[model samples]
Structures are given as structure tokens and as C-alpha cells.
Target: MVNETPQVMTIAGTDSSGGAGMTADLNTFAAHGIYGANVVVSITAQNTQGVRQVQMITPDMVMAQLKAVADDLAIRAVKTGMLGDADTVHTVAKALQQFDFGPLILDPVMVAKGGAQLLSDAAVEAVRTALMPLATLITPNIPEAEVLTGMTIQTPDEIMAAADKLHAFGTQNILIKGGHGDAPVVMDYVRLTSGDHFWMKTTRFDTQRTHGTGDTISAAITAQLGLGLDLKSAIIAGKAYVDATIRDGILVGHGYGPLNHLAVVTAQNQPEVYDDI
Candidate 1:
């Protein structure tokens, strides 16, 4: 008997909107044809519009969930997002360090779409000290890159500078998403600590349905890695998936909006116009 499918895990918060967090992560993995495992860190009271409130899960519960999944299933790859606070990040990092499981993807989720604080200033240090070193890759938007690097990223050159600063934190690869900048095209730059670089460019979709795009991108990358794609290839594929999802946006919420999670699976066999990638 052949299992034929890779398994990936997402350690993230829960979005009640069914758009972001674990829900989106699992859906993205499914879209990428991977079995998804998940560990919920926080329960967010959010809808299509924005995050209303967040309920932080205890560190002990997080540890228990990670241990339970790792002890049972062979997680081929893992992605971490929205760890709530410093303690939660440390706990997850400690468990990962203790068990030493699969390849890890870290999405530095510092703020929500509505400009809400998702990670604390104190916890940012914890993420750098504890988790960033163990990550196979770190996906950070421009704001997140600024937070992590303490440098303003206004141009593509500055984006490279930010990536270099993040590399010093021990992350193997840094995917700095340039969607937040003033560029007409969304250029996501992938730089490896080993001096390898890949740039993926897609015309920016002028839509507000970017709420869960980051989570979806990181999740898709993890799933692709689980399916044995190299880091650069996975990121390239992930960006394509995200761009497609945004293109297929349904405009669900009144505020920020949600992505089209099913677009990938539905369009998998369809022709690639290069728009969907």
C-alpha cells in the first residue's frame, strides 16, 4: 500500500472567519495536495472584516498539542504563524528544539490586516531568539521586515538589506514579501543565507482581499516542501498559488476580505495562463 501524499503541519492561531490562521493553512495544504496537521495557539474572534478580539491559549496546551502531533504523525514539514506572545513562541520553539521534527516555516505575523497588534514587542525578541534560528524559512511582509530588521524598506535594494539583516538571526532563507511597498507589481524576494536568490513577480491585484494571504503563502510553501520541492521552488509555487487565490477573490467580507482557498485545487488541472501560475 502506498500513501502517495505528504503530510504538513501548521502551528497557528484560529480565525473564526474560516479565512486565516489554521483554517486557511489547512485549506492551503489541501490545495497543495498535502495532508494537514494543525496546532491551535490562539482563538481569534475575527470575521471577513477584521480581528475583533483574540483569546490566547496557554503555553502548556501548546506544548501538549505539538508533542501529541509529533509523537504520532511524521510531520514532513511545519509552518508557524501568530504565536500570540513571547511565552507561546518560546514554548513552541522549546518543543521543536526538544523533538527536532521536520522542516519549519516561520511566518512573522506581527499585525493584523486592520492594524491590530498580533505579536508583542517583548515577544518579537523571543521569536528572534527562540524560533527564528530553528526555522527553515521566514516569510515576512515589509512591515514585519521593518520590525525584525529595524530598517526602513522603501525600495528593492532596501528589501535586500532587510533580508540580509534577517539572515543574521540564523534563518536559513528569508522571503520578504514586498506587497506593502509602493510598487505597482508585487515582488517577493527570496534570499538564502548561502547567497542564492530568486525573485517572483506578479502584477498586484488591486483588491483588499489580502487578509489571509500571508498565512496561505507560508502554508503552501510548507506543503510544497513536504512534497519534496526545494525551498526556492516551493516559494515560487507558493507565490503563484497566492496570486491566483487573490485573483479569484470573492470579496466575502465588508472590510479587508478573504482569499479563494479552493481556487488551486479547482484549477489544478486547468491550463496555466501564467496568471494563475
Candidate 2:
């Protein structure tokens, strides 16, 4: 038998701060004992403070990086985050079709914590039409879900309704993060294509260290998929990892600080953040 280490790829942007984007993805993949590959779609001059500047890599270069990784690596799963523009989003959509990476987790990173625009308004439509159909799972935060469904989400019923709208867009699974909610306990909603849904709730952590939380969670899910976990298990495991990660936060910058990627997590070490709802 061959020595097999699951290979995972992240197609997204880079954070100069090394807290989010490609840096965080590689870190998460490594933490799961998986081989990590990357295709940089953009680069940002960002730190714990915030994103100061952004430069989108050309679509051709993005495709080239994907080609290099696809040709040599046996990528078992892949996740996308922070595609800077409409062209980059479409470019990734095409590559996902051309390549056979196992599971596709699309994190619709639209805006930064410090009011920086990561994805343009036009790019949002591109992601919906082009990327959604190709994704195995689409993980969007509350605000993003609002934009995608063209409606407001104030209640849990509305959250599930938004998931319905997202489901019609073509992904088999939908996870709308509730971190932006005003509730004392944060709840993340997940829905399968068959209309089945699950809720994972954890008391909100009062902190400003959630910079790369989105990318980190999606990365963990992708790595878990590469390791042969089912979709539901992968998502819940991702939540557990993120919950532990946020709980172990450290001060890396003045603004939205980075998550504690160094936090070693196991099924046992995972906090009792799960709630029945």
C-alpha cells in the first residue's frame, strides 16, 4: 500500500497579515495532517489592523496556478475564498468544472471585518450563477446570505428560507453562519438539498479575533472531506474546530486579531458548544 496523506487545495487570495485567506487555509490544512496546495487569485496588504490594499491576480495566472496544482497533486478536496472580482470568480468556476477535486466548499467572502470590499457587487452575481452550481457546499455568513437571497434574515425561519433560496442556486448543501446575529447564542444553520436541516448553536464569544474565521472553517471542512468524512460530519467537525479555535484566541493585531490556529483539537477536546434547536 502507498503512504497516503489527503491532499487539499485552497483557491483564494492571500493576506499579508498571514491571518486570513491562503495563509489561514494552509495552516488549517496542515493542522489536519493533510497536504496543502494553493492557487492565489488575489493579494491583499492586510494585517490585524485591516485590509489596506488589494490587487487581483490575472485570471490567466489564477488558471495557471490551478493547472500546476491539478497536474501534479491528487487533490482530494478543495475550497474557495476571496475571489477578488467577477473575472476571478468565473475563472475559478471554470477550473472547478475542468478539474475533478473531490468536494468543493465555496465560502462567499464578500466584505472584510474592517469595511474593506473583498468581492465586488458584480462579482457577487457571478458567484451565484457560476460558482454555486459547482459547489458541494456553500458557506455564507448572515449578511452574505441576505445578499444572495435578496431578502432580510431576522428570524430562524428566515434563515431557513434563505437556505431554501440558496439551495435553488444549485449547491447540494448550505450553511449560513449566524455569527453576525444579535443573539446571545450564535447558531449556524445547515440545509441539505432534500430540505433537511440542522442547527449548531454555541454561545457567542465576546471578542474581536475573528479575522480568518470564515476561511478557517471552510478549510477544515474541505480537509475533513478529503479525509473521507461525510458532508454532515465534515461540517459539524468544522464547527467544532472553529469553536475551539475562537475560544483559544490570542492577540495578534489591534483590529480583528487572528484565530488561534495552534489550538490542537480532537473530538474529545471540542467544547460543548453544540446546542439542540
Best by TM-score: 2
lDDT per residue as tens, model 1, 29-103? 888778998999999999876789999999999999999987877788899999989999999999988875588
Off by over 4 Å in 2: 1-3, 266-276
TM-score of every candidate relative to the true structure: 0.93, 0.95
Model 2 pairs whose backbones collide: none
- Supply the TM-score for candidate 1: 0.93
**What's model 1's lDDT at 248?**
82
How many steric clashes between backbone atoms does each model show? Answer: 0, 0
Highest lDDT model number:
2
The CA lDDT of each predicted structure is: 0.85, 0.88
lDDT by residue (111-139, candidate 2, tens digit) is 89887888899999999999999999999
Q: How far is each candidate from the true structure, as Cα RMSD in Å?
A: 3.5, 1.9
